[model samples]
Target chain A: MSATLVPVDEAPAPGASRTKPRLAAWIGYAGITAVLLLFAFGSPFFLTASNIATILTQASVFGIAGVGLAIVIIAGGDDVLNGGIDLSTGAVAGLAGTVTALAAAAGTPGMVAVLYGVLVATAIGVVNGLSVTLGLRPLLATLATMGVAASLELVFSQNLKIAVTGGFFEAARGSVLFGIPLVAWLMALIGAAVWWVYGKTSWGVNSYAVGQNPTAAQVAGLDPRRYRLASYVLSSALAGLAGTLLVARLSAAVPGIGTQILLDIILVAYMSMIFSRRRLVSVVGTVLAAVFVAALDNGLTLLGVASQWVGAAKGLLILLVLASVTLRGRKNR
Target chain B: MSTIETLAAPVEPSPGPVAAYSGKKRGTLQASRLVAPGTLALILIVFSVLSPVIFTVGNLFGILGQVALLALAAIGLTLVVRAGGIDLSIGVALDLGALASAWLIHDGYRAWVAVAGGLLCALAVGAVNALLIVILRIPAFLATLSVWFAGTSVQQLLTGGGAPIYLSAPLVPDGFAVIGRGYFLGIDAAIVNAVSISLVVALLLGITRYGRKLTMAGEQPSAARISGLRTNALIASAYLLCAVIAGFAGVVLAARSNGYVPGSGQAYLMDAIGAVFIGATISRYGRVSVGGTLIGVVIFGLLDNGLNLIGLSFFWQDLARGLVLLSILLAAVVLGRAKSRPATGIFALLRTTKHQALTNTAKGNRK
Candidate 1:
């Protein structure tokens, strides 16, 4: 444990004096205008309710995952020291969902089955943490777990999709009391919780301090290994939650559930982290970034573009965000 | 005794007490590297023993072909990794380069021209990666991942999201096929390609000033820069070399498969990275060795071939690979720790037990 340090006083506090230069503000405004124009004149399909709903759904899952991943990135630093990437998030979710479905198929209670799935997900996270804390490179460690998780999914269940328990599916798929989608509600709750923990807890300060300098943190009487382990564990658990919900909503755990999901999750999360300009992880920022990507994907699909085209666009957007952030960082320096 | 001697022979000189302690702490880590390939080999041998077809020439050759492409790329990657940069984009670069070469051939360009074009294309991508990392200031991991995304996109665009091209020119096919298909005095083409690349890369890395610079950058980037070594230039060269080799391997790979798809080269990225890291865990049981990577690739290939011959599903193959990577990584860590911490000494003894005491007391006070 360490002293709790509020991020608000760190730099670029929300609602503080506007630091936006005229040029940056104009560019931001212009970018928004361009997006609006694209939606308006590029295609009428962009305004469809189904398209909007699908985009929201996509954003909700990805945004939740992004928030969790961003915390790890912010806690680890620029180099992702000890190789602290959480690539297995999608795979963990996939495996967890598959297991949950398998259990439900065998007559397990929905609640109990879901709990088992989450525990499995936590185990994956624990393995990731153990490897990194014990000196396994983060990328290699997660990559290994990803393979294991993917294989386990295939072994436990063939490529076939399994239906979730009726109650769980209906509950997850339905809208909340308000007009909000259940997925959106879940995402919002996760995001708000993350924001609170990151801003108001000793854990958050420890994470930031550890990322800034692991050796220094250790010298300062902090257990760098413990913080990193906890961060990875939390991140993995959150990812498991995302996976469980995805399976519940869809009513099936399909093979390849997390196939290529890492691309979007990592890209958007990193973009959000960069946009915050503090190199600090922000749940709100990651959610917005995910929303932006989901909107783009949804809009393009509605416009009749192929999925491959959408993939290409995602890559371009990642590059654009990375480039802009990098340029800005250099300028500040 | 022979086994013990072999294991202990390659061990680096213990750096006094600190080194001895580190060595002891790294016991599991040292064991893990060899363990991965060993486990892989064991599974392979067991499968091969059970399945007659696993030992057949054609099937073995097929596996060799796959291993060759992966080993060549891993060799190139070894340099970059040794220089402290990992190239995630190599896989995509290979795809893009292959596509470029294939496109050239399809457009009536000579085979040599196509190959050159591929190499040039790879070099260009590699250079851009360097600029991003060395000049514009991006971390290698992110920069390389970006390149992966960009390169794959470009490949998809050029191929129009279609299947990979097949080259059918007679002489070109035959000559290139020999490198991936034809055997020399009973040696498989793929094995030849892998062995040749390994030898060349090993020699270059072990004997050249460039190799020294590569390690220098990896071990201490700041110090290397301070030495006025043109660190960025060296790094760019290393990445470029890695990309070119990957590109060449790509073409050879496409020929072996007889066609391409978006996912053709996808599997190789993880395999190559694993091989390189695992190999790095070989020397001193915790350092990298080209010889070790060759063994890694061969073990992987044997495992894949043997499993398929034994009729195991893809799930089993994936599981085996995962277990190998994790086990080896774990071994490397254990070995590294063992090497850094001495097995005995007053200060060392105090550091472990007393340190815990101090921390516990400190925590109690804070509470």
Candidate 2:
């Protein structure tokens, strides 16, 4: 996976030259900040430390899942055939939660239950990876996995919400350090680790190379398929982790839980691209975008807006970002 | 002016993998074209053995009725995919159509007017999709997905918190009921509508210049553009037609259910996509066709009917369907790869390079 294995001249450049003003890249951050300020001014409860903590806690699930999705998109690139996307992230999360909840109810140790849940999700991810590397389109491959995972979730949960209480659940739901939830902390740690791995490691560089142009990467001696497969695995594993945490936070494994927030996860991942300097998906940007989305949802709720409006607002926001990005790209060209 | 001449020039059959694959035998049947029908027959045989009730005329009609809406939706999906785009928001159009028409009928509007209203609403969605993808340059996948996300929320708002709008039996107009349940020539009206629509689409795509150009645009947009084909306009029309057809399906869905069910149309989204792709395996070069999509829909309908008849639980049915879809796709991919590979020769090298160039261009156009 090392870029150094290929001669420097043979490798494709990492990214296009940064010609756009730095201000353009900061639009996403500015938009999030403006929204936060609007909420603070509009609602007295919005600025409270507790509310901030709640937003972070709420954002953790999608933040963790978004990190994985961002990696897949970055490594999958923009090509229609090879571009990586995992439609099963939400289903994987739901299935993992179901597994953990069922195992815990069966008197399994909390750690082992979590392990079982993650392993099941990871195994499904392997299937997805194999499907894509074996030449099935990424969209179709993940879509098939999504269906299988959702059905499995129903089978395991018996179409009923399985409530789990005790050891791990109690800790996950109740634990807070310095007024911040444990899940939020875990999300941050995962994001930071991924950022380092994606930015500072040769594996990360090679993944970018592979995404940029697979044929070129092949010519340069990098195995693009391995990186693509690894990206899917990482995405699903993180989704599994998010699902386990979601179950602990909710104290129940609800059927179709992951599917409910799938749009938000995808939105966070895609929106993060607008924040990156090179318009690529990045860990830091995804985490930030997730928090912003969670905060928007929280603020809208506090303002007594209907949940439906919040969903519509998110869709509109993404469209606005996409339009501006496209227009900007055209102008630059 | 020059562009018009280029467009008027009769299209020369493209020399590519598709032509190469089909060239050797003009009159002979392609084995790939039988995959879907073969799978359908296998399912029919297996299900008939598993359940005594499967062969009953009543049950067979029931399966056809069940597949009608799905067939319409998948046909719509096929057109969009053939025009080089995906429409994830088709369910949105379907739901909106059902809701709008149901609301109108509930308010005592004439059946025809209500149907028109539903289709209009769906057409608006198509317009938004066109603006995003064709005008604003958003990728079709993301654009349609956004519409789906926003559109579902709109449906919820209209329904006042996701409740279904039920039309009581007494208020149900005869015209509306006829669309869904009445028989025409001993066949369900819904089934009749689906069949006719499928035939029309088949003719439109297979015989009309517009249809051929749309397929050409999808397969090779750059070449289409060079030939003076209005690819953007063709793509936009495809989306519009897809939405309208899906909207019609939704209207029938509403009439059949005697109300607008808020999320019922969403159920068809994945199934429709699965059907279209499964149908793709039936084409020599993996192009989608109306006949193939119909067969795919029938296969799904049979699985649902047969599995339920066998007393399999709902979850097991779902699992079975998912596995079936996965195995079919895997088989198709493996078969395709094997067929394309050549043992040795300069001709093989040339073929491989041509195939690579086609794929690369397809990828570039999609971006």
Candidate 3:
């Protein structure tokens, strides 16, 4: 899928212009850092090292999912026709995570269990990819995927939350290095990998082109469909990994877990796009925004606000950010 | 606007090989055959084979009664779809209506007041949705999504952890039950009531000036605007009108159940969307119609009842529904494309702006 760098205007995100994006990314990061520092002072327990670690870990789970979502979003062309949103993302993750737990509980090796989980998720992801390329409208295909994933979750879990009954999450939750949870670092690693791919590779640049203008990409002799397919497959695979991490965090495979977290994942992904070099959705932006969201959620919970209301707050926050960004764009124009 | 103009260019010849295959009348007939009744035929065959017990008129009416609320939601959504827009908030909109009525009824209001309050809530929901899409200029899907999120939150706040509103306390009038379970002559009141609402919508779509402009605005927004139609208002009104009907359905559901149940309307979302889209394929106009939606509703109603009668668990039922929805959608895409090669919003429901900044700024520049 890697295309030779052809230096197209639509393909500039991965190379020569890479240096220009750093400044904008930092500007966004600065806001998030300030909020973190504010919370550190405002909430008595905010600055605690454990709490900081917890927030990062929480953000990382959502961040991994966000990475997949951001990639998929960036892979879509304007003419993609309501094609980019994937409502089934969380469901896919939950299924993968539950399968991993179930596999581990049945005495499969932990590594193998994880492999099995990822593989199953990849298969579903491939199906999603194929559907888009095969001319099923992205919205309907993904909506159907969501339905199937949700139902599959119900069938597998039998409406019950399944505990791993083994050491599935022990390493995920217990292992830490350099003052950060292993999972958080894994999230950073994946984020960096995605950033590198989009910033340094031709295939990544080609995807950017396809997203910008599929006709131009097609005329350039590039297969936009493959890129689109790859995007869905990649997102599904990442969602699978997130599902496993989610199980690790919860120590159980909870049915319908995706329903709760999918929105947040999508929210963080959109936030990442908003906060980043608005022209492009970047990995750094997604991770930073996810962290910010995690901190905000943690801060509100600490203030004794009900989680239900917090859900509303998240939705409102996204709308506010989106509106401001849009309004600002209009003003500039 | 150019894109919209292209869409509004009165039914041009399709651009591909399929265009050369079918004659005009034959192709139109073939496309219409695949929509609503096709789904019904599919359901009737499979379900009848699976469970002959559910293939009866009694079961049919029972299924209709069960899906009355869903039919109402679909009818509302049909208007939105016909306008080249989609609403993801219909489920929450239903909740808003039910909660509004519940609040009024619990406060010792008469049944009529509660019903009025429910309709008012629907109207307000429609207004808010209009402001979001028309004034704020967000895409229809995202606007409704925002409404869904905010409404769900407000609903939670309103209900305080979503406690059910029991009508047992001062008792809802016995006459209220008629809306859900009453009989008119030999037919079930719920079915009749739902059908009557569909009839009114059909008349609006078929004969009224409002309907004409709405069809024009959706199928050809730029053309409609050129002809002095308030396209934005028409789109917003479609949403508002949909919400009001959904609200009415919620009230009836509240009456039937003897209380207002939180989040109960969520299940209707998929079925409503499924019905409308499927309805379009089977529709003679290949546009949204009350008749097409009614058939789709009956199809869905039967599918659910049959699936249940066959003793499939809820999860299995959901899986079946999902598969059925996907297949129907896949077929719709193929048949629709074969009939009209134009790639319009009707087919591209969610393919709007993920990058709101670009879409909005561009839209502003055009204006």
Candidate 4:
């Protein structure tokens, strides 16, 4: 049950931080701002306080999910296992949300519902971890889980949206600081916790160790299996947490909720390589990229463009990042 | 003995412990061939018993149509899977091509031109995927997955927020629908196409030098490189072939449906993957053979149609497919290990299980 320690981010431009031009770095962040500025100026209402708040609020769910995915991605350092990505992340989230909503609808207490949801999500992680460690190919394993989980959601919710009202939903949607929803703060807290673990603690070090070199980690007396297993657990827990919050925001839980969000979260993680100065998978990178994508979508919508075009924008943006990352990789190589 | 030899003929020659694999052959009954066909029959018998009122000859032929589309993509996917690479975007690439071609037919273009346009988009996608993997040095899985997401977005943009595009009967030539819907020689055209594709791809992979090199490079790039093979080019061609064929699958789908729906092609991904893997269980060398994949597709096609006959809910159908895929994957792993891990052998007796383990290592290194 040892994790195969292949550096996930090693496929990208490994020397991205060193090879990238200073001005390009500026452009990455500034371009996002420029997009924001264009929308603000071109569309008068975009600069309004309410519009800005709306964009941030919209980004919160993605922000939370992106951080979780980033954990799995960043867990590997030199010999990264980019294969550790959870394609079923969204489906697990949807399932968790559906279960939570179902419980709430069935007159279950709020804490019980939330607990039930979190447990289901965590179980998905444990399953994914088990499959990977226990001999199934990670990609196929997750894909299987994805299909099963999505269908299970349909089974759980009986192919119907489960709507609920409860104190938990209120806390999920209510604003505590700066008029932002509690979910946004939750995202920040989760991101901060992950960042702390990743940068400061032995868990982070062991994860990187396991990803980069399992044999060495084992020699150093660390169980790469535990860190690898824990990585998926932490990631899915956050996804479940976000999905629960999403149920509150949308005021209903659907079987297919994570279908789109999962893709967006992965995109957020991958795009982090470009948006971040370091080009490594990190909590800061994931959160910023989530906001960046959310902002881009918001800007386009504000400019009166149809939502479909935003999809095209995302595709083109990924290609741009990929191309840039390749260029940097070649320069360094 | 002839049957045993035929069954054992397709095993991968380059890897796996010969002693272990051949040990199963000593029984005069190969495991892979027995189990795959056995499972398909089991499913048929059990499901048919459960829903005798629904199973019929006509229904089986109708199910062939469903098998056709999945087989086409699965065959294309076999090109990459054989090379130890993957094309995660094939499903979406099919949709992209379908939407593009359907858009053309929606305009004033000839049906053939529109189909060509769709294939062109698929080729473009494949080339981009190849560039990412070969040049950027990205893993085939991630490279293809990224493009898959991007491809979905592209489809959304083309449809303008997931709108459906239609090609009416009068909108294109009469032969347009014939590709997918028309019957040829007392069989569905889609089935004809799938069979023809399987034959051609099988011949090239089994008989051609390029195909051998592809398998070689895919199995062991360092070995292939040392042998003077252009491993990158070989890998690149696999990606290209996968995309181009998938593009054609998209064309056929468009013809059958008379247009494109934003996410119509996504459903095929699971079955296509299932077909390829299931093919491994039936292959001569435990390798992915086009013929084996074709069989795999038929099994899946039947399962899908049979489940429909049984009146399973759509979610249950998905659940069934997922469960089936996991079982197939698990079976392959178990069967492969049993074959590769000898209970005892002439060479195997002296060889540690650790030494024999690498036989399967370089073969299924999808991760």
Candidate 5:
């Protein structure tokens, strides 16, 4: 496909050196520190240990989803035209949550309910993979799935919130390991595993190759199509996991719960690009970015700002990062 | 026969043997052209059978109005897509326009002034998008997405935390009423607006030099820039025009609803995108066209109205719409591939002996 020939924005040229990436990483760290310090000074509650843990817990759901989005953006690329994005992430999450909640309500075991949710999401992911491999644009294909999933969420949940309690739900919400929620620990472990795989494994390297230049990857004896499809499947599966976790945390499967966090997932994933070496989206970067975003949200909420306004603040921050990167690129050119 | 001839004719003139080859290819071209209209006709027939009220004058007019409002946004989206960019913030422009106008009217401003203010607000968003994309070099998708996020917050702030600003009949100016409720020459004003806007956009894209330049800039930016075309200006203008047009749709929506409902314009975003892409199937090269968008809008409007009339719940309607869109997209892909390579996969197995012979003959003639 002609799309395979399109170079992703984050794909550094062959033989590019490491110095610039180091400098970029430093800049990203500095930015994060600056924000944290600002919040610390802005509100007394922001620096409290309990508030910090609260932020981590709040970050866990979308943070895990952000990891999946980061993988897709890294492997399949983030370009809107030729590259791909999974618009169905939030919708899939929402559907997964509804399915899991419904299953639990029907007296299914917790593990079984979770399996049903993730499996259903994985099935949708397969459809997305089929569509993209069949030559449909990823944006539009995922958009179709998003609509379908959202509709199903509404249909299955009957447009009402489904309360889920006891067993796994309560455990997921209440259990803390070392002063942090279990879900937060799960997020960290997933982040660490993904980081290791992406940084040290051949599969990760091959996926990056596919995103950087699919034609070259094919020439290198890699099946770019398979890799791209796998990335999407992985993304949707993680979204499903995140959805289940979110429902557990909320103790309810709210109709549109997944979509409500979509903006945050995208923001965190894209924000991670800034922290990644050479601006390539990385799992470690995504995890940190997620925490950073959660802190910002938490701080703003404490400062009496509405959630939607915090969303606006995040949007503006992303624009700033984009503008800075563009300026930097121009200067280098 | 003439319609078929026009549809079947090659886009560019060819000589001698090539003309004969094109004549053979004409069959496939004609079939491709028929797909959208044929689908529309099938939908019309099915829906009319399903709901007797579908054919009623009032319901037909209602469908027309709905189509008009949707077309206004889809057409604007078509322009941006044609310019090689996607504007995710089209809904933002729309909502801002609606909110600005409605707020102005609520504050006792003249309806005309309020409408202009709304348009200007939308245009400002376009200007910002242009600055982000053209100057800062951000991708259109992310740039407009941020705008959409920020714009939603702006709307919330203006509406006092997302409350709808209702305009009572007594407070509604005659100009506003005419815009929403008035008829002209036995046609609803909204339909008139849609038709005229469609005509003007068609002329702009089809007949104007600027439009041609914009299309070229979108299709081949580097080539256009090398040819001394101001690609940047053209692109910027495209975004600006897109915002203003979407803003106009927002105005109409506000008038129709007699209030500025926060995020109401967002309801059109996905549908408008679906319509534009569905319309792309009509073009030989998959270029977006104003005429095609109108057709898409009509199809969507009919489906929405028909599904409502069928007494399907809202969730069912959403599912149906999504499935229909997916099917259309998949069908377009499958049919396009089959036309190009008839001896492929399941399609090859499905072909009858007579059809196979015909395709082979066509291939031989092309060769």
Candidate 6:
């Protein structure tokens, strides 16, 4: 799919001009640095290698998920359509972890458990895609499924702790290559896959075409609905993988663990989309955005800012980034 | 003949590949299929049959009491959405207003004064939203989301992480209690409040010039602008209207709850938006209709009430509600498109009408 309808005046051919976006990039870099410095100066707990690893470890799942979401956004399905929003990612992940836990409990091999979890998560993603394609407002459809999936998790084990009972949890907890968590490795795999599909696969082109101008894409023979569904499904699958890693790390599928996941993921993903310099989303860009946020939060926490104020800071960053994007987009138009 | 000349001709030979697609007729049919009350009716029946307690007076009143806050909140949102904008901050605005009112009442302020103060605060928030979007050039979604987060944090900070403000006996004067709990004729206060608000909004949307202009701006901004409508002003004013209504609703909810809690408004945001969206599907208005919103609220209320009566857990109830919403949207899309396509064998009125028009035009050309 190609966007042939060039809006009368083409804005400087995609990244061709030497004129640098120097200021925005600098501000972003500076913000990252300032937050890191503040953390280093404010607390002894912040400087520990373990703490740094922990922060990055925790940030990986969200960053991985951000890549998928970035695809959906760049593909031309505005996150707002059909009442669309993805609030179910965490729940989807939880369900996947629960499946893995159950299988692990049933004396399944670690590899089998992992496969089961991923498959279930992928199925859930497919459900999400179907609902969206069938014209259910994205939010409502996903919301319903989120509730269903969450409830199913509750009913599955009555909120039991099974992540540890299974060898799968051990694998999740295990370091694969010198102290790096298995979950971090999973993040890398997911990131690499996403990057490949986004940059090297035809799906990548279709995604951009769909997101940037669906009508144009449709005229050029791409099925907009199909691509939209695929993007959502891919996003759900990634989220599911993230969930599996979470359970593997935590050794449990606690019912309430997913409460803040959606908010955090959406904030980072939305912010990333707005700041995507290429006007097309990139895996690198999305992951970096997630890292930027995680760093900020960790830094703030290390700085001994009250936990309550941490949320406010996240909200403030979202405002600043999104505001800049909207303003800049308007100026370009 | 050149393709351009052939396109310029009103009556083309047979039909072009895309000539069958007509926007207005399809829109009307689609709009009719999307009406809100149908789902409400279905849910009401299903719930009534599912639980005997669902139809009981107390439960009905409970549902009404719950819906009042959201209904009020949604009135403002409906106005905003109708004018081609959204207010994610309504949730926070509700929080700020409810707490502000509670604080004032605790500080020995008159209940009415406190309520007014809350409304004013909400209005101020709305004004800020408007200014940010219209003047600062912030997108509606980002601006409102920021305000929402900021307002929520501000309220949280003010409370010092304490519990919500509780009203003393003196603050709950007879008049105030009456508004919160009293019955008007046979209808409870909550019902009365909800109905009255719905009616007022419906009237405003239906008869007012401003309402028409707002709708026009949303439906076709370029056309509206060409007609000299002040699109930005209308958009700003719409947010303002939504804020005031939401503010008032917040006060009412606080009164009903007997205090303002930190989490008071969090749960209602989705419900309010759902009602607005559902309501839009209900009428010819296409974006928002007060009656439709009422129906949406009723449907949701019934579902919740019935589910609770059946001893269903929170998770299942949420899933069911989401399913209903999703089904409604899907049904809208499917049914909407269904009507636009060649109808069934017995209902091929569209084909015939076009055929007749074409023949008549051909005869005139021959003459």
Which candidate leads in lDDT? 2
Give me the displacement of residue A326 in model 4, in angstroms.
Answer: 3.5
lDDT of 2 by residue, B229-321 (tens): 998999999999999999999999988889988878878988898898888877765778898788889989999999999998888766777
Q: Please tell me how candidate 2 rates in CAPRI terms.
A: acceptable
Q: B150-235, model 5: which lDDT tens digit per residue?
A: 99888887777889999987898989867767799988989988888889999999999988998888755655776889888999
* Candidate 6 ranges with C-alpha deviation above 4 Å: A1-22, A44-47, A78-85, A98-114, A136-140, A150-167, A174-176, B1-22, B26-36, B56-59, B341-367
DockQ each: 0.24, 0.26, 0.27, 0.18, 0.22, 0.21
- Local distance difference test values of all predictions, in order: 0.68, 0.80, 0.73, 0.72, 0.78, 0.66
Question: Which 10 residues in a row give candidate 3 chain B its minimum summed lDDT?
Answer: B1-10
**lDDT per residue (tens digit) for residues A159-257 in model 4:** 888888977787666665776656667777877888787767767766755554343445557775677667778888888887887888888997687
Residue A17 lDDT, candidate 6, scale 0-100: 20
Q: Where does model 5 exceed 4 Å of error?
A: A1-16, A20-25, B1-34, B341-367
Which of 4 and 6 is ahead in lDDT? 4
TM-scores, in order shown?
0.84, 0.91, 0.88, 0.84, 0.90, 0.86
Q: Across residues B1-367, which tens digit of lDDT does each residue of candidate 6 receive?
A: 1211111122222332124423235234454344456777777788778777777777777888777777787777878877767788898778777877777877877768888888998899899899887777665766787786677677777899646788876567665556566788977786688788878888888898978998877545545776789987988888888888887777777667778888567677777777777666654324566766777777777888778888887657666766676666556655654565533211111122232222222222210
State the displacement of the C-alpha of residue B158, model 4, in Å, after optimal TM-score superposition: 3.9
iRMS, model 3 (angstroms): 11.5
TM-score values for chain B across all models: 0.78, 0.87, 0.84, 0.84, 0.84, 0.82
CAPRI classification of candidate 6? incorrect
Chain B of candidate 3 versus the native chain B: what TM-score? 0.84
Best by DockQ: 3
CA shift of B101, model 3, Å: 1.0
lDDT of 5 by residue, A1-333 (tens): 122222222223323424334355467788879988888888999988789888998899888999998887767655655566888899999999999999999999888999999999999888887777666667777888888999999989989999997788898888888888788899999999988776677787777766654544555578867877888898899999999998998899999877678888988888887774455567887888889888988888888888668768987988977776655444433
- Residue B214 lDDT (model 1): 80
